[model samples]
Target: MLKVIYILLCILGTFLPYSQFLPFVLEHGFDIRLFFEQLFANRISGFFGMDVIISSLVLWVFVFWEGTRLKMQNLWVYIASNLLVGVSLGLPLFLLMRQFQLEQQTDTAIS
Candidate 1:
């Protein structure tokens, strides 16, 4: 059930953001300058932009620290997810993997 929720979240995370972003890319063809211009064009947008930047940084730290503590392999996949989609995809994806790892550990211990 938890895994199912995480999977749903991963789908939402990717689809929701890209639903907005894909059209921008199609219209603008990856205009970095214009993107930044619009991103920080106002205080409200700037707030969200700064928040996401900080959130990404924090996610990296958590991924490195907790992921290594759990001995989770392919940690780069989480980072790549973050880079490609944002926290929406990255966080739920990590949690899904973490849950799997935890279940595996419990099974091993029980055995």
Candidate 2:
């Protein structure tokens, strides 16, 4: 569940580019273009990028830790492992995790 939330947050963060056009962001004097340019330049942006990477890595490690805790049988742990892989591979893997969980629950109840 934590992994799912983290992946969802990453997807949510992608929409942040559009947030620059919002009145609140604009009111705060945020410059979208400059931000993107700096990101493209790969320079320090007050540790934002570093923090993102570090947090993502930590979340991924936690997912693995949780998996080991579960004896590799809990479906959620597998879903979480996939979520981490999805994050690493830059794929829409989280959505699949959600679908798998829904399907698994329904299947279990029917059995």
Candidate 3:
């Protein structure tokens, strides 16, 4: 059930942002320059973008530590999801995978 929720959130995170970006990209010819131009277009947007970037850096460190500590096989997948989607999806998706990993460890220990 929790996994399902995480997956749904991932879908939402991907589609909702893509829906906005796709149209813009199509209209503007997919220029990375323009994308950054708009990203830092104003003080508010610059702050938001910087916040996401800094937070993402912190997230990457945690993902690296926890992924190694837990021996998570799909750590790359989590990183890709964060890159392709957003932290809103990737963080919870990693958590969902972590939950499954913990459950497996518990089951094995119990057995």
Number of the top TM-score candidate? 1
Each candidate's number of clashing pairs is: 0, 0, 0
1-111: candidate 3 lDDT, tens digit per residue? 888887887778778878987898889987989989999999999999899788777778888898888888868887887787677767877888888888898899999
Give the TM-score of each candidate: 0.98, 0.34, 0.88
Question: Where in model 3 is the C-alpha error above 4 Å?
Answer: none
Q: List the residue pairs that clash in candidate 3.
A: none
> Over all chains combined, what TM-score does candidate 3 have?
0.88
**What is the Cα-based lDDT of residue 110 in candidate 1?**
100
Which one wins by lDDT: 1 or 2? 1
lDDT of 1 by residue, 1-111 (tens): 999999999999999999999999999999999989999999999999999999999999999999999999999999999999999999999999999999999999999
By TM-score rank, best first, the candidates go 1, 3, 2
- Stretches off by above 4 angstroms in model 2 are 1-37, 40-46, 72-111
Flag the better candidate by TM-score, 2 or 3. 3
Runs of candidate 1 with Cα error greater than 4 angstroms are: none
Give the lDDT ranking, best first. 1, 3, 2
Q: What is the C-alpha lDDT of each candidate?
A: 0.96, 0.51, 0.83
1-111 in candidate 2: lDDT tens per residue?
656765776565445534543654566567767655665565566476566566566655654564455333443543353333334332234334544555677798899
